[model samples]
Target: MQEQKGKYEDLKHDELGIKVRSDDNPYLSADLQQKILQPRRLSSYFIVLIESGSITYHLDSQDFTLTDGHLLFAMPNQIFTPPAKTGDLKYFKLLFDENTLALLPQQFPFLVNPSNAQTLVLDNPAKERVIKVFEILNQLLISDKYETDTEIILAYLNSLLSEFNSAYFKNKGPVNILNTNLSKFTEFKLVVETSLTEQPSINAIAEKLALSTNSLYRIVKEYAGTSPKDYFINRLMAEAQRRLRYSNTSVKELAYELGFNDPDYFSRLFKKSTGKSASDFLPRQDLSGK
Candidate 1:
């Protein structure tokens, strides 16, 4: 079996760490656009709104079709494969890095993607509003004559994300911005992500988050449908899958990289979690957009 590794891409515009593209405007050059059509790992947040027509996008080996008034978003480090061709597709695509995200005054919880939904269906009114915001962002970033103030750009960006956050959570459930349980759950995910490699115990995580073991378990199970220990195992396995798909690192090296002391133990855990041996999991063919 031949391995197909994905190229890692970073934000092109370093000054703003953001880029917006629409049907009328081509953000990347012909060469870069071709690269985008291939399988790659993105180091920035990616969102696309389908205003009209339709297209299918390949993300992490799953195909998602978006039609008019639909939106799709992918977090950083996910494998992305743009459609090979867009026939009469009208859309808006936004890309921004974490550094750009930090400039906003308040955090948008939806960015954490608690619902595990990668796509949102926008109503007519919400669709119109989102399109208008995209147009404004497009004009602000692509202007050659006037250098838009960073503050002005950030304001529009903030508004656009707020709209997305609201629409994303509206149908899922009632979300109070100050809900204590939700906040604790979000904090738990963040802490796990921050120290994933360390493989902290459930009690340690609960202590760090100022929650009891039982409270942490309930919160994690409610949101993730798994206990705290299982959540950590699942997250580690997911990261392992991502790394395996994008790189040629051997099982031993990969285990050590993920902070596992014993390669055999990591292999067993991987098999238990993924139902495939580390070696059998490689040479993934779908990564080539097949």
Candidate 2:
């Protein structure tokens, strides 16, 4: 199928996959804006820090009304579109790839399959700090130089992530290591992705991560704000949604592909999690796949 999605390699010019946009720069470049606004997945990760704006943005089939002091994040392979219309908005948008993400010292738990609250309302203090970091990187990126100082850019990028990371986890009851729950949560997520066809149980995942079921539950709850079983189910449901919208697989085939022993059971679980049967979404969706 023809999957018209945006990837960092296709979007980058400086080899960093780092693009920043605001009122100052090309707010929405003609070359990329229309494709981005279309219903497609992004290959690069994105963050939008809204200084002031009134627009509805969709991420993973959910609509978010962005306004003053709001920050939004999107991960790769996720169905996302920029605001259909840009209002009298002042915001900074940052996009980078997984390689660029490895530059940071910390693992942003939010980037690793954020369970809830993709948009955060920041206070003035946090907002100002985020704005400053964005400004610094913006200046460096758009600078006309012989060679892109990728190292320097990565340094500021790391700081930007650190600032955002601290703010992201501020209310999570005081973090010890920066990647405490984040790293384990990522490991847990990885285990599920690899075993999607195997349909591994929660205990198997916990064992792989060297944690007991209880510890796994507590950690997942603390980090993702959901139990491990619920978190896994949500992940499965999201994949099912993606397939329904973007692939040609029938619901029954999708269930089998996702390791469900029975298509009928998968259908029920889909309705419980998403409030609509797969069949309900199929007819309205534009199904295509790579």
Candidate 3:
């Protein structure tokens, strides 16, 4: 089966939302083939468990090939674009807001600092447990009286997320060594995201992270498999895509907005990183005609 490119929808859901194969969502079809495969961001936190097939998923600037047993997560304000999909793909998705996360008794550390790798390749046992939880939540949401039954929905949501968080953090490298590596990497990413406009130099970033320049290099390489400079550039490029796709801003304007000193350089960099010129790169989020 092949996926058809459907019209994009600005899907509106209540704060706490759930959807499974049986739902009538534009993103999910009756036959379980994905529609609305486009580049866009999610307003709410998004999680999906893939049971089969492949997905060329673009989260920020990184492209991840997710298949069966993979659980992918996207925090709010993060850009998530499902650019390509296979007809064989089967998945369950859950979307919720910060308030729903707060309803849980304990905060999940994985949510606070997403691992270096966003997708968790779960073991068979873990996959079965996740499937069971998702089924129950799906049943709750599709219930006729769900509006008044939000508390029960939320309780199950918390439990489902807890299971996901546990599976995501399990057997992830050597925890003793990875704990430090993961923390430093997570902190560095947050700083880059928050201070991306400044376009901080490698030295500045290393100093802010309180690591020696050489140490910073290894840490970034360990997590991102790229130099800090390249990683930051990629981050900027993802932002560039978001802005360009959402509006008709000129190339020069985009450069300045992202704090690049030279528009020409920004244009070259964008083209180099994305394999397409900024002007020629098509927008995916503009749905005014719809």
Candidate 4:
């Protein structure tokens, strides 16, 4: 089955690179809801907080069932397939670009998703707090009064993310912003994301981060639950899945594009990582020329 090539969607209907919507919002028309049901690549950060009811969201090739108190987040360039029918689900959806994130006072480490956990379960107290923040954001974005102040929005956004960050790491123990090990792990993730196709060596990454290979391995395993080499391979496979799902890139081209010298080897590795051949993993559809 050939899937339709998914288009990359940017933040629309908002000037500040941010938009918030809730069940009560009148602007969420049937047409808009239908459009979201299509599988598309997102150009901005996407988040959904389920206040009530349940919906299964498809991100890349994974299905995440989000119900009450569950928050699902996806970063830029990810293939997202919203539920075909929300069916009375009360949810707060947020879309913000990298520019909007830049305006924040502090960096949000959880946004990088070091643990590779896309959904976070919030306790009752945290859930109530998050819902209030989301309500404020929705109101501010839709206010008919004089222009809504951008600073106020950022303040609330920062608060919302703080709640998320705390809840994200709550089980793992508090993350010390000053922890050098945590910083190194975050840097490792950034390097991998930026130079994924380059496939840099673990030793090279450790040297760049001013850490010994042993120390780097410990940090990555502790945070990501994978060895450095395995983490890099997983990242590569994920990118391959994204390209394969959203474009018509052939297996050979994908292999070379992802820095694999042998397309055959790439195919085997893909199968090993995902338990399915690249062709069988997802339908090959190329709607985007790029």
Provide the TM-score for each candidate, comma-separated: 0.90, 0.81, 0.65, 0.85
lDDT of each: 0.83, 0.76, 0.70, 0.83
Q: In candidate 3, which residue pairs clash?
A: none
Cand. 4 TM to true fold: 0.85
Candidate 1 lDDT by residue in tens digits, 1-290: 01212321332333878999888897458877777777788889999999999999988758899999999999886788888557888999999988788777767777767778889999999899989989998998888876667777777988989899888878766668548877788788778777989988899999999999999988888888999999899889988987788778988999999999999999999999999899887776344544
Worst 10 residues of 2 by lDDT: 1-10
Off by over 4 Å in 4: 1-14, 26-31, 174-178, 279-290
Q: Model 3, 1-290: lDDT tens per residue?
A: 01222322332224444545412333445343333454456766777788777776777767788788887888766767665445756777777766556555655556644445577778898788878888887776666653535556656776777787677677765564236766787778778877988998899989988899899889888767899999899878988987887667888898999999899999999999989899887545453412
List clashing residue pairs in candidate 4.
none
Against the true structure, whose TM-score is highest?
Answer: 1
In model 3, the runs with Cα more than 4 Å from the true position are: 1-38, 51-68, 77-90, 102-118, 140-155, 169-171, 176-178, 198-215, 271-290
Q: Which model is ahead, 1 or 3, in terms of lDDT? A: 1
lDDT of 1 at 21: 88
Error of 4 at 75 (Å): 1.9
lDDT, model 1: 0.83
What tens-digit string does per-residue lDDT give for candidate 4 at 152-257? Answer: 7778988998899888888876768448888789889888877899999999999999999999999999988889999999989989988887777889999999
Q: How much does candidate 2 score in TM-score?
A: 0.81
